[model samples]
Target: LRQEYLQHFQAWAKSLGLGHSVQPAYNLPLGMQADISLVEAPELESLGFNEDIDLYRQFTGPAHLTGRNVISTEIGARRIGAYALTVPALVGLLQDSYAVGVNTMVIS
Candidate 1:
């Protein structure tokens, strides 16, 4: 059903000549929460940037698999407080996301 809606929306956008200009938001289930494994992983304590990289992979992997042109993430300073990351750590998160496959960041 999601794919069907995407296709229909794409066609509508194309008709309006806005297909290339607009990017869809591929939100993950659970309103942008990290996967449970990432939240609970013991190795996260020591993994540093690698952990961010891995989490970015998990975030964007599904969108890539589904042939999405623009992969996005809903992340912000407040949203990631549970991770106990510093400001530099948060920057690293965005960087890692781009390094993997996320082309768009939705901070909300």
Candidate 2:
């Protein structure tokens, strides 16, 4: 089902002239679950699985293994009451993502 979905998405992107520009981005937990369900045993449900950090590892692993040209992620700065994330904090988030093999980022 996942392959089918990817195929259809690729075709649709090609139709819209975005086949090369459209790269799949998977978030932690939910997106990880969807991707793992396609290829792995879904061991995330097992005890001792660290969903927080581990999901990032798991999600990035496949992109590297498959030799994806770009690995992108949606990043957000933590909100503090009335103010949004600080500039330094946002830079920290981008740096962390780069350390984890994310070459592209969609900031929120």
Candidate 3:
């Protein structure tokens, strides 16, 4: 029943030219007929690059699930570090994102 609902939802989403950020292994499947249909990174504290790597695994796990090599992230999307987010911390964040297979980004 869940799979049926998900399939129906996927079809509806694709019909609207949209996709959801659902984990294929957990809930919804990762394939949708949108220009871009993948996971999205949420705000995370600058807990160092090593620790941050795990933060995006959920998002990156299916980054390539759709056979599309597009990976993306949003920079400075955190209030934990505030404006104090230094270059190294930012680099670490980007590096972590890269390590997790993020190939695109939107810095704001």
Candidate 4:
């Protein structure tokens, strides 16, 4: 149903002389978080100021040197919305990013 609606909207928008292209969505697993603590400092230190490092460094500090851009799940389940947890919950959810030492986050 959603696809149909999008398709109809796209056609209508195009007919109105507006450019409309629906891009593919990026999907991240539900309940996943950044883990920034698992990385070894030496590995991060060894990274050169190359293109790869330039791309990664924008998102995190030495702890998050995975060289992979972090993309998050934009939508969450109702269960997540219903829950109320403490800082530990945030810590656990972000352990992966923490393992890699991500100091900054990019929403997209």
Candidate 5:
């Protein structure tokens, strides 16, 4: 991620009580719709949740029947890209889980 974007994200997360212990990962799934789930398995695994961490992974694959509550943390800004459009096309890879749908959740 660019330094400016990182600064914005870090500030936003800190204000919301998410600490720096939650490391940020970038550019996952290398083709299209990459940023939709940038903090994927590797990042999540590295977190190794403690009682206070409450770490969650972005959807990695199709949802299994194990009843895990999946959530999305997709946030974006206004720009000149198709992903700057909507949520579905952005997060269509992992098809069967909760989407936490947002057309444009944040624009800063």
Candidate 6:
């Protein structure tokens, strides 16, 4: 059913002269939270960034296999102190995401 919907949407967009496409969120990272509800420094520490990069490669394997070039997903949202994140820290987080094939991000 999902495949049918995706193809239909793609075809509809193309018919309307739009190049929009849909992709599953196969990113391998936390949504500004770890095992906890509110995100903080402690929660960030539990992120899988320290894990093997191969894990993420596998996580996004499905999208790659389907020929989807754009891997978009939400990040850096719902934090304990959302405004406390420094510029460098945010940059580093994005850098790590890029290393795992995150080209477009929806920062909330």
Best by TM-score: 2
What shift in Å separates residue 98 of candidate 1 from its native position after superposition? 1.9
Local accuracy of candidate 5 as per-residue lDDT tens digits, 8-90: 76567778977332223433332212322332211222112220122222323321122222323333332465445467633
Give candidate 1's root-mean-square deviation (CA, Å).
Answer: 10.0
Minimum summed lDDT over a 10-residue window in model 6 is located at 37-46
Q: Supply candidate 3's per-residue lDDT for 103.
A: 72
Candidate 5 residues lying further than 4 Å off, grouped into runs, are 1-24, 28-68, 81-108
lDDT of 6: 0.45
Candidate 1 residue pairs in clash (backbone atoms < 3 Å)? none
lDDT of 4 by residue, 18-47 (tens): 744321121212111132222111122111
lDDT by residue (27-47, candidate 3, tens digit) is 234332322232332222223
Q: Name the best candidate (by lDDT).
A: 3
**Could you give candidate 6's per-residue lDDT for residues 1-108 as a string of tens digits?**
444554566567778977653322223333221111111101111133333445445434444455556655455543457676677766766776678775676565
Rank candidates, TM-score, best first: 2, 6, 3, 1, 4, 5
User: Per-residue alpha-carbon lDDT of model 2 for 1-86, expressed as tens digits?
Assistant: 55566556666766786634332333223454345334321222101222234555666666666555466555663434435667
Clash counts for the predictions, in order: 0, 0, 0, 22, 0, 0
TM-scores of all candidate predictions against the true structure: 0.47, 0.59, 0.51, 0.25, 0.21, 0.53
Local distance difference test scores for all models: 0.47, 0.50, 0.51, 0.33, 0.31, 0.45
Model 1 lDDT per residue over 1-108, tens place: 544554566567668867332223233333122222122111111132234566566545655554556555555435335656677866876676678876766543
For each candidate, C-alpha RMSD in Å? 10.0, 7.3, 6.9, 14.8, 12.6, 10.3
Indicate whether candidate 4 or candidate 6 has the larger TM-score. Answer: 6
What is the descending lDDT order? 3, 2, 1, 6, 4, 5
